[model samples]
Target chain A: MKAKVTVRLKSGVLDPQGRAVQHAAESLGLQGIQEIRLGKVFDIELETTDETEIEKILETLATKILANPVMENYEWEIIQS
Target chain B: MKAKVTVRLKSGVLDPQGRAVQHAAESLGLQGIQEIRLGKVFDIELETTDETEIEKILETLATKILANPVMENYEWEIIQS
Candidate 1:
């Protein structure tokens, strides 16, 4: 089984990297870009095929290591191949 | 208009970050995690609603700024709200 996890900063949180990217875009002559927020994606492959077990494992990983709960949020889905 | 861009390392590319994360997970007592790959996501908001123009702008950003063509690949979709 595979899991795709996305972790993003919560609203109102300051993102310096996003700001830097925005500035880079402007310098590159790419117009109309109003805002940008940067996030992370984790592609995980597990040895098990149990959906329930995979969900449980992913939940723990996302909260414990993948995201900063105080400032970030995460969502994940199981991928079928 | 909004654009969600996902950038990932191409297959066969070495990812030290992913390996570090895997080690961290093992230390945390999370089992069954076979492999992991880390990627980046960008949420961009544009001032214009023109689809054609937005695609052109995002294409440039994804190619030149958001991803390294030699090692990484990127995909983006326009979001309407």
Candidate 2:
């Protein structure tokens, strides 16, 4: 099984880097583009096939690996291909 | 119209930040988590509704703001509510 995770800053967060990207995008002629936020995605190839175990693993991953519990929030979906 | 842009390092690229996060995740007891890659996503609330115009805009945005033309690639989807 494979899992893909996306981690992002909560809405209303101050993301200076994202703001910079937005500015640069606008300068590049991307009209109507307002705000930009940056985030992280993880592509994990796992060894297990159990759904329950994967859920438990993802919980730990989110709390410890995928995000900073204090500042970020994450969502993930498992991919079986 | 709103747009979401996801920017990432091309496959096969080495992302040190991602690796660091992966290690961190593993240490946090995230079993079955192997490799990690960090990326950026942008949420833009646009003023225009024309798809053609948005495409042109995204071209410029990706080339200039969303990614480094030299090392990164980006994909974006428009959202209508």
Q: Pick by TM-score: which candidate is best?
A: 1
Q: Name model 2 segments beyond 4 Å from true.
A: none
Question: Each candidate's fnat, in order?
Answer: 0.89, 0.76
Q: Which stretches of candidate 1 lie over 4 Å from their true place?
A: none
TM-score of each candidate? 0.97, 0.86
The whole-model C-alpha lDDT of candidate 1 against the native structure comes to: 0.95
Q: Per-prediction DockQ, in order?
A: 0.90, 0.66
Please, what are the lDDT tens digits per residue for candidate 2 over residues A1-81? 887788888886788888888777766655566666777777776788897888788778777667886778899988986
Candidate 2's displacement at residue A52, Å, is 2.1
**What local lDDT score does residue B47 receive in model 1, on the 0 to 100 scale?**
97
Best by lDDT: 1
Residue A49 deviation, candidate 2, in Å?
A: 2.8
Model 2 per-residue lDDT at B12: 74
**Ten contiguous residues with the weakest lDDT in model 1 chain A:** A52-61
